[model samples]
Target chain A: MKNNYDILVIGGGPAGALAAKTAADAGNSVCLIEKRPAIGTPVRCAEGIGKELLKEFIKPDPRWIAADIERARIISPNGTAISLEQDKAGNEVGYVLDRKIFDRELVWQAAEAGADVIVKTRATAPIMENGAVRGAKVLSVGTPADIRAEVVIAADGTEAQFARRAGLDTVVPLREMMSCAQYLMTDIDIDAGSTDFYLGNEIAPEGYLWVFPKGDRTANVGIGISGRKSRDGSRAKDYLDRFVAKNFPNGKTIEAIAGGVPVCRPLACTVADGLMVAGDAARVVDPITGGGIGNAMLTGRLAAQVASECIAAGNCSKEALMPYDAGWRASKMGTILERNYKVKEYFVTLDDAKLNTLAESIAQSSLKEFSVLALIKELITRNPKMLLELKALRDTLS
Target chain B: MSTMLRINRDKCGYCGTCVAVCPEDALELIDAYLSLERECIACGICARACPLGALEVVHEE
Candidate 1:
């Protein structure tokens, strides 16, 4: 296999695959490296993606969709539930994806676009030359090898180790990280075409529990808790177990998973000379929802587009990649992500009483539909004092 | 040999994160409670992965 290429993308998830495919399709030699033996295994995500966000990039492939969501139900601590139809939620409708197939198909698309695919190849560190990232030291099938490149895209997930190795601050504070645990189980009763989110500090401190139905009698039951609230040996699994015991007493477990989600604003910087960070590495996830697959793919496409431009211009410096940062930040997703972070800051502090009250208010609201911001406005109208506490959020919404 | 990992069932949330992160795949959830199997190497990944601090690795020298 060739050791040198025009672009090298680390991690084979949606971001890496999209970046690699876009770059290669633009006629640059690209190589996508995945540490796992397969493109997608031991899946870590909750497997949900917003429908409208996804439609912007690729057509829905039936093979990867586990279930199509028609509506969502949010149950407050007091069991005050507010249900929202899909279209009413501002295109928040989504699908529970079969990430194994979806992730693999993305890498396959990359390969089909002329990028080389290497599995079981782990990037150990960035190769710095003249103070710029130029390649990586890797352990390929347990053998050390150096792969050189003009531009390196770090698509590594929440850990963001690659970006750090390249001298970028990608560290996620425990407070900003959400510890998640999920079980793919059978014999659980759920609406096959709807998703449920349960809120309450006891249910999931500083986070929420999700029941995403994959099919009849099967669902992905999980919970994500704020790491700050999860201190003192509190586990997300413990909360999930309690929820299941109470809700699905007869449910049987099929698979269990533990993962972390970065739930903060995007990093201040995600690009440097000869390097760019995409996806979770850049903290491109929605702070309020922890949804990232769509943003990751979008950022990947943008980064690659910028990389192609730089290659054509014969300038692979940080200045050349600056547009990638600007481009993403200017997009609709960038604005939404920024707003969501502010929303999370305010929402995470709401107690069960407040959450229940908020739910009740939503149920009584005359509006037929409401966006997240609209809901926030409705919430503020009920508790005017909240306007003072959420000044940043209030200003953003206004 | 007894496994070094001790799961506090009372505290375990049953998210199975420990089971998922266990490099050896030595952990499983039976009836929504944690069960340690023979393959466990006591790697402490599950201990770290446990958000509730429910899984503890007891070191006996």
Candidate 2:
């Protein structure tokens, strides 16, 4: 293994792998380090990604998809369910992936692009030189090693320590962070082509529970709640357990996982001298949906693109990496993410009654013309007092 | 002495998120269970990250 490289990427998820691949393909010596022995074990994501966003990078390979999602059903506390066809014009549509295979394939692509892939290599900390990140201190197979790099990309997922180590204000407040718990269950009846979302404080305080079909009779069922609201010590697993017992009483649990999801805006500063933060470490996840796989890949590519340019110019300073930051903010994702954060901040504050009202309104409205604006209009029309929140929602959606 | 981080194997789901969030690098999943190592500073991240509430910090008075 090389002790030095042009680009060193931490974490081996979608972002890190793509970053390594992009940089390496540009002829830079790149290395990707993953703490897990395997690329994707103990899967933490719900695995749903938008087709439009994903198509920009890699074509969807059938080997990675577990189910072709055709629609999404939103159920309110009052039991009113609103169904949205995934094929609706201008709507986002995609698949629920077999993340283990998908993640491994991504890293494999990175290796194919000439990036050295090292698994079971835990990045302990950012190696700082003159107050700037230059590489990482790693623990690979119980041996401490220092890998130096001209540029470092941190894609460390939800447990993001790398960016913080590099002086980025990456702290996600409890309210903005989503505590998630999920169960991979089988022998459960579900719409094999549709995803289901249950919304209610009783269901999941300040968040939603999702049932994403992996295939016939199997799904990844999970719940995410605002961490602050979970201060009562009621675990997300408890809510998930109750939801599962009620919805799929006889369902068998195949696997269970838990983690934090940063449902917030992107970091103000994701770049420092010779350092760039991508993926969950940079809080690129959609604030409203808690979906990030697509965004992570997008940011990874952009980060690497700018990093490669800087390396070529022989100036990997913070100012040189500003293009990555500017590039991300200029993209369509940048617009949506900036708006989604505000949407999430306000949406999570709505009480169960308000959510029930919103859901009921959407359910009663015409499905063909239904839109985010329509839902907000319906809510504001029903309750004039909801004008402020509705306006904020309108601002976000527009 | 600080509080000791305790892991209840029965409640643990073996997510390994606790190991990831432990700043002290004191946690690991071995044989489908979480094993606490000597480096534990009991910073409480693992306790918070444990989805099933399987970990606890018991301070000895």
Candidate 3:
């Protein structure tokens, strides 16, 4: 085994790609590895990003724009609909994207910035020298090889392999994780600019249903139920299909995707000696909704900044990289993600009637004035619904 | 070819995602643990979907 890289990023997802690109842009040699031969194969996400939050790194290229970015529709438990338009003023969200293309585009940026990407390379183990991780022992395309670097970043999504091997505590409690499933259908009757949100346990117990319209009558219809309740004999995809079957009689199913969303906050420690974690790997995902794209990209950029700073000082130790944690927390990404996690637990525990009433109450409110916190407070403000539910939400949350 | 899944049984919440993604029908949920009884090819499909780090395939020595 011989050392050759300044930065080695494992996994070619958003976080890995961004770290490689940013480090390369800073003139550090980077080696980016993906376990799969192709960059982004077998998509596992709903492929949605808040376009407003994407300016942290590079400008939004027209090629990266998946569909019309704009407002969303809120459907109450009783099925009351309330619409919000950007013209009326609300948070701007992007439409469903072709994740395969979006992932490849990020890789292209890394390559242009001077990083070498090797696909089908599985980083099976960390290469530790003197109790400090130097790089990795990779099984590249079925052949064993040692690829070394000064700093190694694991961006392997929610199931972070490198993080676990480096002896970091990588766990997102089952109750906080969302068991999500999706169906891609065509000829769907949904507006391209409006994302449809269905929240109420009766509709999709312990979770919500989403319709991400991508024009051409095609959309990603999905549901995400909390893992705690989902395991108790409920199928999220079944609920999603029932919703689809009831609503879009004329639509045709094209594809299906299933996965879990980490609705937990960033890990207590995301960096160790010569090793760092980013994106979904560190659980830097949203707590309110189980979304990770905006947050993942944000972490990617922040990790890259820290790596660059480390290289300039010729020290990529864990302590040298702690500033990345501080800087990221200072950004809105940390506050919103951690707070949203607490907020999600509250909604996940609500029953059918309570959720429905909460939905209806929220639908009745003005869109611009309706925050996620407002919906929870309206649902269980005066009425102490369940001691366990409240305890589950408020406990263990800082 | 069983998934040869090793679970930190304490961490298993029986989410059943590993069972759903198992192309080989190698896993089943019992007492909040995903039991790997049948042949598991170590495909890793189940491992990726397990959010709690409960399921993994250990190759035979």
Candidate 4:
């Protein structure tokens, strides 16, 4: 790769790939780097994306789309299952992606757009000049090289080391970190067209378990619990193992993947001098659902757009990059993130009985549009005792 | 004299789950290898956060 470019994007996930492609499409020289040797091996995500959201970036290619989810089922602690059809299920009911192929397609598109793509390249440190990030010192395939660029986009996912090294506090709070474990299991009975979510503290404390069908009888069976709730004997894997043992006893686990997702607020400042953070690196994952693929792509594209603008103007200061942060927070994704964070906080506080009561109450009524607000409104109307708490939440939204 | 953290490479998935929960910023996942820095305080948060039970905290005499 070149030692100099207009923009350098760290990480090769959806965020970095989109950033690179967007910037290159804008006629800016861009280079994207991935620490891993391959694009999407050892997939960390559940690979589910909203159909509409996926449409915003790229067409749903069958080569990458594993399952087209037609509905969703929310199972409460009391085994009360609430199902919603595709039209009413909002963004949660969409496509289960094969991320291995999906991520590679994104990078391939980025490369086709005139951006350079390099794998097995780790950004060792930021190349700071007078307290401004000029680029990165990367170890590409064991040979270290200092790459310089006018702007650096940190799309480095959950580890977020590049941002931290560039003087951004990227540490996620222990309580907000979702310790997750997932197993790709086959030979299991599953609704091929429906995604299932199991809620309650007994199963996943302050979190939830999910079963997203890939195809046929194979599915991604996963659980994510609060980091604070994790301990030696009772971790995310422990919970997932117990659930799989009871439910899918005959299932064969072909792949086991574990990672941590930041469910906290995004960084107070996602941009610094000559640097912009995007995707999971910015902690923009949905606090409630732990979904971030769409958000990441959104931020990545926005960051590149803003970076290109600043580069054209010959200014890459933090002030110039501030619009990237403001742009996302003002978008629909931003408003949803703020609302979901609050909703996640409120739901995590509910006990099994409270959840069961709420689930039972909601199960009786049908929501035309299956949004979080719609569900909460249903809860407020059905449960008089939750009126005050739910009203307070609504007030914050307004 | 200090708390020690040991990682069983065989069991470690190198998914960087430990790196994310590390308050001390001690753990770094380099490709397939997971490394520990001197900043590690041995809080065992990473140990607990490890889904594969690949990490352990040991107290030495």
**Candidate closest to the true structure, highest DockQ:** 4
Runs off by more than 4 Å, candidate 4: A87-92
Candidate 4 chain A, poorest ten consecutive residues by summed lDDT:
A84-93
Ranking by TM-score: 4, 2, 1, 3
Clashing pairs in 2: none
lDDT for A141 (candidate 2): 77
lDDT of 1 by residue, A135-216 (tens): 8988888789999999999997765767776777765665677888889989877899888889999999888999998888
Instruction: In angstroms, give how far residue A333 of model 1 lies from its true place.
Output: 1.1
Candidate 3 is graded, for docking, as incorrect
List TM-score per model, in order: 0.87, 0.91, 0.82, 0.98
CAPRI-style class, candidate 1: incorrect
Best by lDDT: 4
Off by over 4 Å in 2: A87-92, A231-233, A366-385, B1-4, B13-49
| Of candidates 3 and 2, the better by DockQ | 2
Kept native contacts, as fractions per model, are 0.22, 0.26, 0.01, 0.62
How many clashes show up in model 2? 0
lDDT of 2 by residue, B1-61 (tens): 5678888888887765565455555665542456875478876666765667888888987
- After the best TM-score superposition of candidate 2, give how far the Cα of residue A30 lies from its true spot, in angstroms: 0.7
Worst 10 residues of 3 chain A by lDDT: A374-383
TM-score of 3: 0.82
**Where is the poorest 10-residue window by lDDT in model 1 chain B?**
B16-25
lDDT of 2 by residue, A1-398 (tens): 68999999998999998999999999999999988788988688999987777788788899998998877888988889988775553566578999999999999999999999998888877999998889999888778999999999999887677777677777666567777899999999999998888999899988999999999999999989876666425778888988888989999998888877887778898899989999988899888788999889989999999999998999999999999998898898888788778777778778888888777765755444324444555556666666766887766666
